[model samples]
Target: MNDQHIVKSYDRDLEAIQATILKMGGLVEDAILLGSEALTARDIEAAERVRKGDKAIDALEEQINEEVARTIALRAPVSRDLRILLSVLRLAASLERIGDYAKNMAKRVTVLADTRGIEGADASLRRMAREVQGMLRDTLDAFVRRDAELAREVLARDESVDQMYNALFREILTFMLEDPRTITPAMHLHFIAKNLERMGDLVTNMAEQVIYFVTGEKPQEDRPKGDRTAYMGAP
Candidate 1:
């Protein structure tokens, strides 16, 4: 192939990669929304629909990874662009995990919705669900726009999500204690709350990937082990 033809082919591959990520992002956002709505409205039908589309998101992630591998083998992009491509794979993985989280929420909906004398979840659960979904929306937007500031904001939102999750834990436990009738639904809310907390973690992963794509530096993972104190001041 001539130089011009090779350039066009490479552009097409890159465009395809971008398109795949956006598709996965859109699906993930929708899963979260539908999962939350299903849980809140006690609509098992909606939950099942969300579950059915879950595989499509997984397929997209796999397809993108394959394309990225092929691009590396054929196009020989520069190191910086290569970092971005690999980061896209990481971001895709994160989004898949997010979809799994949503699926988990949906499954919990099925369980709780069918439980004996189980009603729907509470207002706090619904509010947190919406809040987490918004963060996912914003994080994906930052990725598309390549807005570092917005990405940082998304990272910051993880803390708030965590705080809300803790509160949900306490509040739900209290509700269950007050009335044993609330246990089934409360447990369902617990699963959804855990999913939202994990969603925050996944979005933070996406933000880290965004920074990596922009700077070619893989951000350090957050591991809290006595602040590395055992080795600190030892060397």
Candidate 2:
């Protein structure tokens, strides 16, 4: 009876950890949405909100780390439970990175708000952000459902994000070259596009973690990277 009670308590603690991860993920998603909207709409207030939201995400990651460590020390979970706790730590870390990227994008929005608008650049960036946000949502759902196939789908979508970034990079570069006045805003747009691309990579890392958690093996093959702007001398 004592052993059974201990097992139940451990299970409850694990559930709490998972719940906390989900909550953090939700906040990160909101940050992405709000950050992108602020960029496109020139809403400084919304951008500020995204910046502030990152603190909660950071606090949650710290809490998750502490909880996982305490569980490991007290419960001495077996290999399976240990894998889960380790995955939880990795997932929270990746989520924190995504949140940080979103905050950075929001900060850029403040700069862009003062500059003259680039034609169609803001819309293109918002679209890219939406695609990334969808991937994050699906990736988290896959984690919750333990659906390896769904995770794989999320992995596949990263290529689309890369393509979008590359196209936007070229567009912004053309604008910078065409009009001297557009150079400042164009550079900020380039940075925002790069930020979104990195966020997509982080989301792919999360999907890979989901696959690892489910199958006990990392994806043996690297998905082809579509981000070729750097190699082609894109700026």
| Model 1, TM vs. native | 0.86
Please give, for residues 1-235, the per-residue lDDT of candidate 2 as tens digits: 5999989999999989989999999999999999999998889999999999999999999999999999999899988789889998999999999999999999988788889998988888999999999999999999988899999999889999999999898888888888889999898888989999999999999999999988887765667767898686644
The TM-score leader among the candidates is 2
Model 2 — TM-score against the truth? Answer: 0.95
Taken over the whole model, the C-alpha lDDT of each candidate is: 0.78, 0.91
> Tens digit of lDDT per residue, candidate 1, span 1-235?
8989987998899888998899899999899888888877778999998999899999999999999999999999887767778788888999999999998888877777766432333566667667777887787787777777787787777777777777667667777888898887777777778778778777877887786676556677762211122232311
Please report, as a residue range, the 10-residue window in candidate 1 with the lowest summed lDDT.
226-235
lDDT of 1: 0.78
* Prediction-by-prediction clash tally: 0, 0
The whole-model C-alpha lDDT of candidate 2 against the native structure comes to: 0.91
